[model samples]
Target: MPGNETTHPLLQRFHEGDPAALGELSDRFSPALMGFAGRLLHEPFLAGDIVQDVYIKLWQRKGEYDSIEGIRKFLFVATRNACINQNEKYRLRQGQPPSSEDADPDEAMRKLILSEYLGLIYQIVAAMPDKLQQVFYLSFEEGLSPEDIAQQLDIPRQTIKNRKVEVYKALREGLKHYKVAMPILLKMLFPH
Candidate 1:
């Protein structure tokens, strides 16, 4: 759903103007995009509106992307830019100046790129087998150490460590296309 291998066929169908493929893409990505926009704008209704606009734009420009990866990148980048514009408009309407803290263009671009890559990583993790997924979420999302995860999951500590190693291997293989180094992925996932 986040531009992994399974999505390649769907993306190919969409490029051929198949409405069902468009629907599939929308179903896969809309919720994540809504959450991303909501975080940026701090308004659930506005975020929904932005995500709707994104779908509309995607339909209108279906020929633009030959790969699911390209589509995924464009979807997030477009949603982010839309959210920034909407935030500025909302501020103007409330008689408040646009936030100067976020005015730096480079910082904004970095945040957008980070968010996109993180979304891809999340998709890969979600696709993992159940035990491995649980291990990874415990390690990263819950900020638990391998020992803590072993206790929580009623598994041996060594098994937990092994599962973590498997998770790293899976992530590295899945994200090879993005050129993400294992160390950076480890920092993002394990974050000590």
Candidate 2:
């Protein structure tokens, strides 16, 4: 019962050899993976190849994962490894020594953790109402002040503040399950 509790419908479908399920999983996770790989490798073309390879590897080992979280962990580790391998190869071609700093295990793990947090935040924001989503993006993503957002959206300053409070409440509620992660996220979002 405990084990099955964590089983996702997509994961079950994937285990049954459903190609569409794999595609759906790929669609869900690829953007985050691509962003991670692109930042790690600094080559968009190489990053694309790495993300594709990660999905292929996931499909190849489809039976190994029992939960969506497991699949996500596998994808992150595989993508990171592939990026490191590519960096090593590039270094070899350029006749440069392998950079030790590039292979810091903790750095990769930290990045993976941050990516997961951001992915969860994205999911929460996606489920928000359109007005709240717009306010959140403008205030947080676009770094606009409340006054700026109010001016741009032609709303009152008090209305912008109210919307921001709603956005914060929604985000905090969505993250309530992640007790350990919530504090870190809050600090990052409101470092003031």
Candidate 3:
């Protein structure tokens, strides 16, 4: 992680819509991401494939990136999730579940779901107006209080609350198609 330079170099390149940045990112972070995947997958070649697959996704989605996005966190989380998914799919295809090799399967699944959920959230937030998106993340993700958010962002507390409300309203309306068993009341709570 390079302070102020942006922790994820690939993300920076991806931000600029540079194909070469994707390659440079692969060269720089592949070693680390591959090593992490190898530990989880316990296969060198498969880990390499996993890293490749992760980069492939970045290449595909790079055009959507903007400067405000958190590239490093996104990469680490997405890679871990993709590796987990790939590993599980491979296991299922082989018609064999792990015997003694099983770690906490529930935890693994939770991680995968959480990672996907976060990625979806990022996509939604990124699609929002820049000020509203930043306010929402800082207030919710960073856990800043309304007063704190006002001070940090140099805005009125009421404005932050209104922005949050507007943001939630849009998400609820936008996600009306999802039948996730989540009650509609929760959407109202967003103040959006």
Model 3 per-residue lDDT tens digits across residues 56-175: 877777656543234445566667777667777777778868532348788767656544444444445556787877776676556677788889989899998888777776666655
Query: How high a TM-score does candidate 1 get?
Result: 0.60
Write one digit per residue (lDDT tens) for candidate 2, span 26-58: 877776676567656735479889889889888
The better-scoring model by TM-score among 1 and 2 is: 1
| Highest TM-score model number | 1
Better of 1 and 2 by lDDT: 1
Residue 181's lDDT in candidate 2: 65
Where does the lowest 10-residue lDDT sum fall in candidate 1? 1-10
Q: List where candidate 1 sits over 4 angstroms from the true fold.
A: 1-19, 26-57, 60-64, 82-102, 177-181
Residue pairs that clash (backbone atoms under 3 angstroms), model 1: none
Go through the candidates in order and give the clash count of each: 0, 0, 3
lDDT, candidate 1, 1-192, per-residue tens: 454643578877887899999888886677557656765674547988898898889989998886776777788888888987888888889999886746798887677666666666666765678898788767876789888998999989999989988988888888788865669757876963
Taking all chains together, the TM-score of candidate 3 against the true structure is: 0.46
Q: Candidate 2, 74: how far from true, in Å?
A: 0.6
lDDT for each of the candidates?
A: 0.77, 0.76, 0.62
